[model samples]
Target: MSCCHAASWLSCARLVQRADALRIIRRVPMPGYDVSFLITAQHLAGPGARQQLVDWLVGFVMECDAEINGLKLDINARGRAVATSLLRSLAF
Candidate 1:
């Protein structure tokens, strides 16, 4: 993805949060290919908040026709486990 695409994705992810705000954890460019980003929800709402965020993300990916094979989410430092699980569940 291009920088614009990454920025757009980050902006959309920010809209899903209501607390500390969304932040970009990291951005890695895959030489000549897609760029990968690690984003996190700043402050969560409740127990299911993370899952809900993930759901929104899956929808966002689908809507954008973005290949999310390397998407990473860090919900309060739970790290890649939850993200991987969610992405796998979404079959992306």
Candidate 2:
């Protein structure tokens, strides 16, 4: 899969078509679950002598998962703030 495609998928909760996800990442709150895979031309050949590639991928995945959870908390907090503001405005 294209790194672009993988990054795009990991960047958000919804499926995006024909857009650059890296650019989109700045705008969307990270999804509740973050999972990513980036395999370059060299990585495919790394199985022969670069076992380190596997280790790096494992670490990358863990980091993404943590980031996703953090983003979810931020999004939820923002939603609650907005709701609270709306309720206060209507309280007279």
Candidate 3:
């Protein structure tokens, strides 16, 4: 028997994906949520780095039951793109 509740987890994953996709095109409003984080390219420069980050992300979402509403990547001064924030509720 599975200890995890699959339905809610899948729904949350879907919501996060949809939010991220929408955020790619334009700014979106995120109400009732305040969750954000940054992941730099330097941290993901080695083998299994992406997978490790994904693992941590999954754990974070499940543990916090967070509702993500936006995702954005920004280019730094050195011309490197980095995942700046997973969700930004504030106006840009």
Candidate 4:
């Protein structure tokens, strides 16, 4: 599930946790619910910057065998840009 808003993202996670708890009560085997978040700067300007960033992100995720649940991009009035990614993975 991809959420454009932070509130929705958090609520979605809560719902998953609740389902997991219900499964536990019924003694059903539950899969790992591990989740990770990555936040980093996104270059807002310069030629080919966006393409380069997308390539890097795709490569990194593929190499780690990670699943992306959500992505958020924000730019402030001061021209600062940020990217946030929600990743899900099996518990180690």
lDDT of 4 by residue, 1-92 (tens): 23345545665555445434322212322355243323234352558855655655454446334223322222342233222222223333
* Each model's backbone clash number: 1, 0, 0, 0
Considering only N, C-alpha and C atoms within 3 Å, which residue pairs clash in candidate 4?
Answer: none
Worst 10 residues of 1 by lDDT: 17-26
Pairs with backbone N, CA or C atoms under 3 Å apart (clashes), candidate 3: none
Reference-based lDDT, each prediction: 0.49, 0.49, 0.45, 0.40
Q: Candidate 2 has what TM-score?
A: 0.46
| TM-score per candidate | 0.31, 0.46, 0.33, 0.27
Residue 82 Cα positional deviation in candidate 3, in Å, after optimal superposition: 50
| Native-to-model Cα distance after best TM-score fit, residue 28 in candidate 4, in Å | 36
- Predicted candidate 3 versus true structure: per-residue lDDT over 29-63, tens digit per residue: 24443554445675577798677667666765664
TM-score, candidate number 3: 0.33
lDDT score of model 2? 0.49
Choose the strongest candidate by TM-score.
Answer: 2
> What TM value does model 4 have?
0.27
User: Who is ahead in TM-score, 2 or 3?
Assistant: 2
lDDT of 1 by residue, 1-92 (tens): 34344546675455334212333222454466453445545424568767756765566566455433234332334666778789999994
Q: Which ten residues in a row have the lowest lDDT in candidate 4?
A: 81-90
Q: Which window of 10 residues has the lowest lDDT sum in candidate 2?
A: 17-26
Ranking of predictions according to lDDT: 1, 2, 3, 4
